[model samples]
Target: MDLLPLEVAKKVRRDSTLVKYTDGQFIQSRGDSKPGISIVRSGAANAGIIGMDGSVSMTTLLGPGQSFGEFTIFTELPRTHDVTAVGETEIYQMTATRFTRLYDNEPQLSRALLKTALMRSHILLEMLDAIRRLPIRERAARILQSMSHTAGNPNKLECRQSELAYTLGVSRISLNRGLKQLAELKLIELGYGEIRIPRPALLSDWVANHCNPAPLAS
Candidate 1:
């Protein structure tokens, strides 16, 4: 679905249920068939899968105005992943029944939402490909880049090293090493429990250079 710009908060605030979630709260759990469409008014969250062995494979970050749960809404299927609030978040939710009515009664709206969903699917596929081909450091940089919008301090990320280690499915030592490598390159700044990217463009450039150099065309 097309995300409403932050300016349209007034439009959504009236009809949608206003809900708040604290950092690390589960907004939706896997296997729940009742996921309603959520329109993010502010803050950020993440959607990811948890492996049987307890490893996490992050799918994507959802920021302000972005959305999650569209697939479940359209298919009536169990959710494939868990959505967790990355920070203090506020969202407006449209229940399954209301969304279903909109889908059935408004063909144009349905088509528009479907188009957005398809585009998101394509982006997720590309990200999965990147995760498969990229090194740990590149993956780390990508995550930091995604978090830039929600981070209170644009340069410093407000996430615990241990939690990130678990989410990335790497040993704390390994994650630290990856962070150290980026820090050494001056792409990121390391703090006690936070990581900083003084220049986000440089960080994005680091990932692009490491993982996706431009191809030469004849």
Candidate 2:
């Protein structure tokens, strides 16, 4: 992450609270956030909405510097997504009252939150567009490419393929098949609970080849 001015960072830091989460623990559940936003300081989290049928559809992973609960604070509504720690995770929490004070006194901090929300929206929209236009294989490739950036190690991403499948809204079988194909191509190395892209350039080429515009044939 790029450096922010000390004052701006300090303001967010002042209201921040820390919490350590164990595996399978909920950092923030759907309908849980009364107010305020939380940031991931360390470790990782899964963010998704729970379906009426009792299904949990993971939308994405939240890593360091990413914040959530903005919707609840902005709209004064219940939390929309359930955030859970995948492993032992640490987070910086802040209350809405505290956030309000900062926003009231410091317009810069307020604009920062707005900017963050807009960035998240753009990422969500891009994911939706890619999934809509491309096959699951290409989508999976792109997902892995994304993970590689956030992933702590190139050899092992903490998320399992099953969990990744849920996040991508693809069947486990399909994801497994795609992973196998990718492994066979030597583009990535797959594991029981992790993934590694040995050659990101190869995966990028795959996405470009599969998704780029092409001429119509007679």
Number of the predicted model whose TM-score against the real structure is largest: 2
What lDDT is obtained when candidate 2 is compared to the true structure? 0.74
Give every collision pair in model 2.
none
Residue 115's lDDT in candidate 2: 75
lDDT of 2 by residue, 1-218 (tens): 22346787777877888889998798887877478888887788877776787567767677777677877767889887888887788888889888777768877766667776676676566667667887777778777765554444444566677667877888999989988887888888887676777777777787668755577998
The top-ranked prediction according to lDDT is: 2
lDDT of 1 by residue, 26-89 (tens): 8888898885888666777667776688666666566666666777766778888887887788
RMSD of each: 3.8, 3.3
Clashes of each: 0, 0
State in Å the error of residue 76, model 2: 1.0
**CA-RMSD of model 2:** 3.3
